[model samples]
Target: MLNGERLTGTGRSKLTAALALAFLGAVTSVSGTSAQSAVPKPGASVFTTDIAPILQAKCEACHRAGSSAPMSLRTYEETRPWARSIKARVSRREMPPWHIDKTVGIQHFKNDISLSDQQIEKIVSWIDAGAPRGDPNDMPPAREWGNGEQWNIGEPDLVVMSPKRVVPAHGPDWWGDLEVDPQLTEDRWIQAIETKPVGVARRVVHHAGTTLIQPDGARESLSEFAVGKYGDIYPEGAGRLLRAGSKISFGVHFHSVGEELPVVIEVGYKLYPRGYVPKHKVTEVNVGVINGHLFDDLDIPANSVTRHEAFAKLEKAARIISYQPHMHIRGKAMTMDAIYPNGQAQTLSSVDRFDFNWHVAYVYDDDYAPLLPAGTILHTVGIHDNTAANRLNPDPNQWVGFGNRTFDDMLQCHVLLYYMDDAEYQQQVAERQAKKKSQTTQNQ
Candidate 1:
């Protein structure tokens, strides 16, 4: 099923719908319980013992007070009222907001917040059992979180703010670039970077993309912030270069939110210790719609579902660190594949349910990150639904095309990777092969 409903589109869509149904069936069977059998017994005590721990580990990060989530789930009092909502969301695999399809493609990630099948079952069972508080002593210690003002990347070594802009109560979307000086005296390596719209600006800002302008006039994309994105934290031994005497530019996209508001974009950079240089420099590659063109022939008819495919060929051997699918409201799903020179193709990642509210970049674990040789082609297939079935669709009767506004449509994927020489690539491939063999043997 595509978005929990059968699709009556092309042959491929029918096949995808069949596969999705089969996958859901497999998941339900593997959990060793049917929907009726999975219901909890009356008066079962599950909240403090089973459900609380799961929430603490998975949900509380964002669902706690001062976080972005609408309500806090830190205690039974704060959570009891939302029990039914939680059950519905978790049963649909929509809560905690991890949208990557688990049945296919790479399964491991460094920052995966998705709950397991057993965890989902537990949450549903608890809610059905009346969401009891049970023994208070069984509750685990509360997880500590920084105040709302704290940066996600921890205390940053440097912080910069963009020039303030006033967004009108109602107007056309605004797009402009604002530049700020970092005033660095010496070169530094960036370990992590975060960008956010301050206060009420979060409601109006669609995205704030920061770029680094070097003293020599060269520019590099530093980091970006969307609604659901956290921050970019480079893996160990890899970092982005920040030259001395560099200025930062903020490319802000603001949409009116029914109230006039003044907005400022804040950027934070966590730096590597002085005198330390990273082995690999991280770079971002954006695979745009229909063969690398950002806004070329992206037409979606009213009340129809359309699919667009894009391809990018690598000029150098590289290790892909993350995959972030980008689209507007009409976006339904996206799948990324890597076609090697020898003609073998592998699906690296697939976001089956692409929610525009959550623009997450799934970061691969170091060992599982794809190592591709030069000439490998990255293929991306994005699906867009301009029909009433897409609840996020602003107007199903309006044909959508490429534009900067949220109502219009665009298709793209952001891939973060570090290029390497042929020798290093070969060595890494061999190491990965050996590691896989060892894992297989251990499992046997």
Candidate 2:
């Protein structure tokens, strides 16, 4: 069974019937045709007053023209045909692509784009009401967006391009390093960084992880570009240093498409003001298997569900900035837990439904980010389904193991850490406690 549904024989029939009834009930509830009055009241002028505002704030950023999403939701005329589809997607909590489990773990995030329950209800109600364009004048002003080539981190202080490479029409996957000089005359702290494939490169490039090589020959991970990752923006008072005479190295993985294509990667950096030093330096660590070989001991039987666990112990107190789970097509779910020195275990994050297509990096809000003491062990559990029930699974009959290709599977989680001394860690803990006390007092 996958996602609590059996995929074969009579089981599949039951699953289908259950889904149909759920969908029908949703439609009826929103339409006010059901006997149960527990459904939320339909919004007043939902399309313009309620639904449009939510889309403008959360969806239009990507759903606009020339954006990554396939359809535009800017105007009623453009969105009417997709109203039912939008309702269905939002009802399943699949759109906007934020997959963090709400019931468990830290709930505060700075970059959360998931719609609230009320927003989803409004959307469903709008679609059930025949998607009427309630009042032309009630429509919100259309959101303004930059052209497709615009940088997500605003104008960059510096831009570097990787050496161009060619991908043949058909061949095995290619992996190599493409290095380039940024030509910075002095050291600078990077506040934000973004990497993207230029032009045709987007089609054939699977992933490109860039590293910073300093003049002293020290290396540091800079940033990475993948399907679901937009970019990395350091939290307030925290930044990564990019020293002078540093070179950028890109570890690129390119797979062949149907047509030959040339690829180039563009890296953008937004730097802090001159002579500015951040309070903390962010360090990224991949918390996975100790040996760092993600699937070395993996043996997944055909048509079965499997689980794997990995652990990373922190030698110093650290504040975790973000959590990003990485897996191949067969990945189903992943959870991160923290075992404190006092032996108290708490889950930091749980992504119940892991969608390989969007490798989202959940940036924890400052107040709620995990603060771990020395010796805290981060434990990650990953679940994989290698059965026909997994629609993305290519072959259920074949045993699967780790390889570089897309057909293979691997499990890993990327976490950003800001190491702190005992004094600083205690100071932060005290401040958080004070703030929480104030909030509770205000509520009372």
- For model 1, the superposed segments whose C-alpha errors exceed 4 Å read 1-45, 149-155, 164-188, 196-209, 213-221, 225-230, 243-247, 251-265, 272-277, 440-444
The alpha-carbon lDDT assigned to residue 230 of candidate 1 equals 73
- On residues 77-115, what C-alpha lDDT tens digit does candidate 2 reach at each position? 667655545665788887888999989999999889998
TM-score of each: 0.80, 0.80
Report the Cα lDDT for residue 182, model 1: 69
lDDT score at residue 430, model 1, on the 0-100 scale: 98
Evaluate residue 374 in candidate 1 and report its C-alpha lDDT on the 0 to 100 scale. 96
lDDT values of the candidates?
Answer: 0.80, 0.78
In the range 1-444, model 1's lDDT, one tens digit per residue, is 222242443343455345445544533221212321334465564677788889888988677654445568898767775664566578778788899999999999987989999888778766555555667798888888655456888899988999999999888767789999968889999999999888777767777889899999977677888655678899888999888899999987787756788998899999999999899989878787534465767889999999888889999999999998989899999999999999999999999999876667788998899999999999988999999878678799999988877788899898899999999999999999999999999999
